[model samples]
Target: MDALPRAAPRPHLPAGALGLGALLVLAYGIVPLTGTSYLFEALLTPFLALALAGLGLNLLTGYAGLLSLGSAAFMAVGAYAAFNLSLRLPGLPLPASLLLAGFVAALAGLAAGLPALRLRGFYLAVSTLAVQFFVAWALNRIGWISDDSPSGVITAPRLVVAGLSFDDPRGRYLVSLTVVTLLTLVAWRLVSSPTGRNLVAIRDNETAARLVGVKVARTKLLAFAASSFVIGIAGALWAFAYLRTVEPAGFNLDRSFQILFIVIIGGLGTLRGAFLGAGFIVVLPLLLARLGAALLGDGFDSGTLEMVQRIVLGALIVALLIREPAGLAALLDRAGRRLGRRAA
Candidate 1:
């Protein structure tokens, strides 16, 4: 038989890409089909939002070595900006409102980062605190943002897109998934690019980065802007998708600390760290509550359980920082290598 021309070899996807695709299938298809409605509304949706917030903080603090205590402030900016845009501009699309909200938050980050040029260490951290206080105050005091509601709590408008309504928990969860996936891809592209290298260099040693002709000031500003932009989108998701309402109290100092802990515990400078850390933070409480109930039964009061949870969480943070400063990502990586070696 005449040899037919060989067909072109099928292109294989990178393992990372294949793994990511499989994860997406699991999240979007399998989870929706098998997971409970309460899980979608209470756990997964909020986890995605918090994870995205951790990713944003990771960019600024992890990659760029900037210290911030007001991550929640930027979130507030995005949430309120998105809320206002969607409310006033009836013609604007929901995604457009979200993008614009991100821009607004970016501006706020730039303003907060201005003093970072001259400040360092504790001083810089304090400067970011100003942003946190200012945003909380504005969101609460500014009646305009809340549309003059007496309670300062406003319900998110219906999620209607292209004549489809995503008003239900499942639909909202899907939206959160889509947003996180897109932003994560963006973060990967950024860290893989020249800008990412600059961020790392600056983080390691600002003086050396500047000596190497890196625009130290510009890079810092860029880091802040990019970080805030992602965080802002997360805020929008938190408000519109997870919380389903805009409240000043939602993005508070405690919330900022939560996000910081997520980055710290998840593993600095690693993207997957955000997700891992968020899962830990979100699931740990439930686990502890269950454990307490199982062990102590009615003797373990809910209030006592909450207090114990916080104490255990603090102790774990200290232990992790001292023992595995690289975060859970490093630990997982080590385990994977060990398994591979054993298999070999």
Candidate 2:
């Protein structure tokens, strides 16, 4: 067989820009080590976890052209899987439990992908929705999942590694950052590989990919499995680092939609978009809410604040789509080119 043509190289930030970014992150990590700021540490963990999940979802929807609405289900699977692993393998460490959880979620993702062989478009989206609901219902029905409790919540045990406890917010934040960074690097590598090219080909045109001997169905399934595995690990981290409790409600449709929105607003086909999008989703609301409260004072209620937030979010999405459908990354790229031209 002849070799496939190489894909165009991805546009990356300049080395100087990358160095600066790394320095900033290093500062963030080192500053907390001096003394913990519970608020900043607590906020950073969830932000990183959600961003990781968004990156996984972007791999499927943005790169592979597979629309998945059951991401939250995979997340739920990871959380429960971790819970069960912890209980069943009492001697196993937290890291091992997290890995097992990701594996379990990947299996679930593979099972969910089986239907994609025959489904597409709205049908495919609906089928994934079934996975979401079914997993949620199953979690509710099983007493073991709930630990025979009425509320059906699973609290993560304290993370003790090599005699060091990550119970403190600072320790947890560092762990989460490390996990996120490693997973993001892995995702970056995966997207630059041959398999990633196949996914993009499948996404751009399935019929053309088949003509080139790409196994369209198999590739799609692989994409889903890989995407879900990453998402599942992110969910486990979320449960352990942020929530410390897992419930079915935590992995609802809204969660899936939120991830989708992040990809759409950040940039559909890029990893950097995932981080930018997650930051927007997580940070913007809080900022807006605070601004709203300051303006509305005691007259504002929670319902009103929520309504305003939705309106603002919807408006921003529409504006971004209309002005720069390629998302924030595109805008940044254009700006960078302009600056370069001016300098030259």
Candidate 3:
């Protein structure tokens, strides 16, 4: 018998399957819940926003191998920029405000990255820290950025789309889901492009990349700018869809660390990791709190619950890292591989 060419292994679900699955799950969760379950929708908005931000940070820190501690600051910049554009600029559209906020944060990222040519590792980290502080300080210094509001909360103006106002939780949730979906698609495309490969190359070995004629400095700066821009948009969405408040304290160092942890726990260098990490970071705490409340009842103090939650979270993170350093995505990938092998 003529040698039969083995049929190409069936490809995994076509590109975007994972994204579509997530969207379906999100939609399913959002659509059926009664009023009493609105908290899920509320919580999901910020979770998705933070996930988008973490995706950006992963591009910088994981793919480009640039350690940045100023992601939250960029997010803050976008939030405040959106606030100012919406409230201060006469006749500015909300979309315009979001774009302007992203642009402003990108500029900030570029400026911060310029010094990266001279510094890296700990030095680069420290320099980004300066950006964090500088942005926070600037936010506090300028009253206009805060909208001069006594409460420092930037309530989103009613989202008017073609004369329809989206003020309800369902509307806001839909908006967040749409924005996050589009951005995640963009991120997926970007990471699959030549520039993404270049960024990865530089991350692996800057000297080697330069030896091969890669524009090392430019690539690094672009990575930084791109990452910050995405993070900025996420921040804008966060402010508009959920918090409706833009405050300096909200985008502090702890926020930055939390994002870092998400990337680490999710799967550094992979877009899937961002979603996984965000889910763990966001849902885990809430789940734990609910469990604690159920077990301990009303008499259980918040402080004890908080402490136990932290300890459990810390232990989980450590366990995950030790067991699968590549994060949850890697675990999933391995499972798929095993399944494929079994099928073959």
Local distance difference test values of all predictions, in order: 0.89, 0.84, 0.81
Model 1 scores a C-alpha lDDT of 0.89
Q: What is the lDDT of residue 322 in candidate 3?
A: 99
TM-score per model over all chains: 0.94, 0.92, 0.89
Across 87-196, the per-residue lDDT of candidate 2 in tens digits comes to 87888888778878888999999999999888887898999999999988988888887577665788888877767898878878777777787787788878888888
- TM-score order of candidates, top first: 1, 2, 3
Over 1-344, each residue of candidate 3 has an lDDT whose tens digit, in order, gives 54454332322122247856876675657563543335635577778888989988998998899999998998998888887787777587666778788898888899989988989899999999999998888777777778776645566676655566666776777677777777777877777777887998998999999999999989989999999988998888788887775678889998888888889998888888888899888888788788888997986677887788789989999999999998888877888789999999
Per-residue lDDT of 123 in model 3: 94
Estimate the Cα RMSD of every predicted model relative to the unseen true structure.
5.8, 2.7, 4.3
Q: Between candidates 1 and 3, which one is better according to lDDT?
A: 1
* lDDT over C-alpha atoms for residue 196 of model 2: 88
Better of 1 and 2 by lDDT: 1
Clashing residue pairs found in predicted model 3: none
Clashing pairs in 2: none
Question: Top model by TM-score, which number?
Answer: 1
